[model samples]
Target: MDKINLLVTISIIIIFIALFLSLFLLTVKTAHKLSNRLFAFFLVLTAIDISANLGDLLAISLNMRIFISSFFFLQLPTFYLYVLSVCYSDFKLKRKHLIHGVTFLIANLVLLPRFYAVDEDSKISFLANIKSMPEIQFNHVLMHIQMLFYLVAAFMILRKARKIYLENYAGASIESLNWLFQFTVALSAFYFIALVKNIFKFTEYPNISAGLKIGLVLFELIIIFWYLYKALNNPGLFRTIDSKLKLVQDIILEEKNSNQFTINEKEHSEELLKLQHYMMEEKPFLSSSLTIQDISVAIEIPVRDLSLLINHTLEQHFYDFVNAYRIESAMDILKDSTKSKLTILEILYDVGFNSKSSFNTAFKKHTGYTPTYYRKML
Candidate 1:
């Protein structure tokens, strides 16, 4: 088969996979129901967009192809909402979310007078000289603008989620946040390539445009497979942060500027010593799912004060502060001759680490050696 025919076949397979995954996400039993549904909707919209690329191969009518193209405006917005849902546990679809559909509505309205209101023959003719059609140009511009806006918004949400996760929690949650961040980065790269492909579509070089289209189909196939692997192998890969949680830096800055707030260096130092003593004696870091709030209540310190002491005064993220203790505990156990027979996994679990990868990372970061290597040196 010719390359175009091969790409068309691959596109068909990708569309099927996307749809199948969408169905799976929609029906899968999980705590992240809203996130799953939003992601499922995003996949359905992606499948529709991919199907639009097969219009010529499928012998779809010009008007139908144009209608299918309008769905592109919704794809990025749906993805942005999915990112929000995954990042914030408290995210709920409200009336304000409908604003995301504005571009889709406007695109359809643009086509209403020019293409959708006309006969099939007129649509064919209009598509024949689509380069000259103002409505078509306007819709293309709108699609690019919407893509840029939503991609930026999605990335901002992921960044904020990462900061919040680092400041408020510890353990394998960072791995899940990193996975989501990497996925968003991959999708952003894909969108960038798609943008280039769209730009190439209007160029004089048909070969480059066709090549980009084929490349995009292959990339989409790989991305879908990657998604399936992560979804199946790591079903619990995404953990949510409360949307109400503010970054420690923001809270510190707000307090610093507030006239009602005053610095008590002596009291702060006492609290720091108390916190360190509590950490060492109580060993609350032994909880894999430990949070700043948990520490706050245990030590009778307010959450805000604890955050300030750990994040601002100590200049350490809550995640790192907690993991430091866990790593230190693991190191002592590793050095003990009595625990020589214990596996690295056992030590990690005993020290409150949920994932071996995270444990190894923290170990290496703290001691400049892997857990096994550190244990062997003893």
Candidate 2:
């Protein structure tokens, strides 16, 4: 019995030491301010949590009560703040958000007396709460309620996070963010489940001591360090090109090399000019998913220069460039008496538009009329 106790004490201390180091390292790392602040809050919670466990191990009932009270009380506030921090884009913290914490505090305070442990007759021995008969029920109905609060906060974070980074390359970054952010949510979920399980086996598994609870807290600490390390490594997210100057440098270098290569391939470049002949004679732009880059590649022209030429000569963005071809093809289709029998949607699909909505949107934007209206007027 004494041997088991000693090992538990030593194992817990080691975990707390790592927890402190992770927090210290996180403090020094550069990050988005809201995430840093929220993570710091979690670090503080870990410290309190460590104290709660250590207090119980020491059998210092007074210290243990203080630690639990403080941890649980502050947790109500940190819960929503952590969510706000994770999902925060504008970094605006409002007074209204405090209501979530305040509401929890008031509810907890009202039920505070029931939290103290009952005398020996009661079965809830591990946690000395208001479980004593006649005074208050031992069952922690409030804890279950708190679990609901946690779920709501975590779910909100998950819901809001989906929209932040929507660019083609941002999917991986979002995945990484979800993995890290989900740690807190996952911990809360485990704690809740273990708690429910504890209630069911309250008599038999007193020895188990909520392994999942301890594990979740430990996991939260470890997750902080892992996230902090990744944050430091990725000053800018992977492949997202965090530096504007780097993008400009790439564009200039690419254009310079394109000009040099074209000069070297003068005869071949002259043959490449056959693209104009093909577009006029073959009308290949009628194909679906054909963008300016596809055309530039086919004609052996530098995409950047082709874009430059289009912008200087035609004053249009790439989106508009593609749509112009689609719209012209739609016009050509409309002119044929046999194809006139085809529906506007069919014509749009035949012209390579992947969706009716997209076809209508692009056609209207380019030709100042919806496909149906354009066909009607023509």
Candidate 3:
């Protein structure tokens, strides 16, 4: 390998280690059982992806044909894992997912004969001599078909994730889901790009193999490692429709009413403090795209708990609670002792209100007057 490839490989190894450690510590330290389990699933699948490819790049005592043959087997499971990990919602284990592994094993059985032959002295030569003659490679065709299924499965996951992210505009886990969705989509696209470059190598495309290896394979390693880093370091990158899902699941699984179960006031205060900090320092509310989910992520709280706390504990709904803060800040801005030349509209957005109409409606709802009337009174 060239020095650049060596550098790239080392960097990816470092990142993979970091992700593994994050996954480890998160698995151990997280009090939330579901989060810990899902994170473990993420780590296991990512580890499989990395480990399968590592045999190729690292030293091994296998002939080139044997190495290539094993790689073909390895690639199947790696792609299957990519589909499975991104599709995972609940941390619950399923027996059906085992079928993918079974199929991968069965595929190797069919492929094993062609790639390995017992020589006259019973020594196995793991090279396909059929390539020297015009011969039908039926199992290769079957492997291609299996790969297509993996592609379809991954694409289906991407579609579902996209729909959930788009439809759950009000919910919080959308951002996390979006991160997984984008990464999945990007990885799939890169794989397809690689596939295309592989196909075009014979069509007068000079250096197509090199281009595919560099742009598709090595870059895939980099992107997937980066993905692990993001997902491990920021567990929020795995999006579940937490509020709705929790409500549904809670109805089924049920929670015991412990009289001792009280809202943590200190944690609540800390979250509100974080929200206040965001409002003061970030001004995210002016974006109109802002929602309770966004705040939950920003505050590092579960959306289901955040919603319940906002409604039952705070005795306020999200909209009223947030708009109150916006309006109060706007009030301070409007009633400033210094002469203010900016319009009420400018002040509204400045205070994180998305529009003049929303600002006016919110001000009137809170204090029984429009901004103009309130400003005149001030």
TM-score of each: 0.96, 0.49, 0.49
Q: TM-score of predicted model 2?
A: 0.49
Over 77-162, each residue of candidate 1 has an lDDT whose tens digit, in order, gives 98889888888889999999999999999999988886888888887788788877898888889888888888888889888998
- Please list the C-alpha lDDT of all candidates, in the order they appear: 0.86, 0.54, 0.56
Return whichever of 1 and 3 wins on TM-score: 1
User: Model 1 misses residue 266 by how many Å?
Assistant: 2.3
The TM-score between candidate 3 and the true structure equals: 0.49
Alpha-carbon error at 176 in model 3, in Å?
A: 1.6
lDDT by residue (tens digit), candidate 3, 125-177 = 33334333221244445555666777677667555654433332322344455
Better of 2 and 3 by lDDT: 3
Q: Which candidate has the top score in TM-score?
A: 1
Global lDDT of model 1: 0.86
Better of 1 and 2 by lDDT: 1
lDDT per residue as tens, model 2, 276-378: 5656676665665454556677777775565544443345544455556667888889888888789987887777665566677777787788777777786
Task: Give the C-alpha lDDT of model 2.
Answer: 0.54
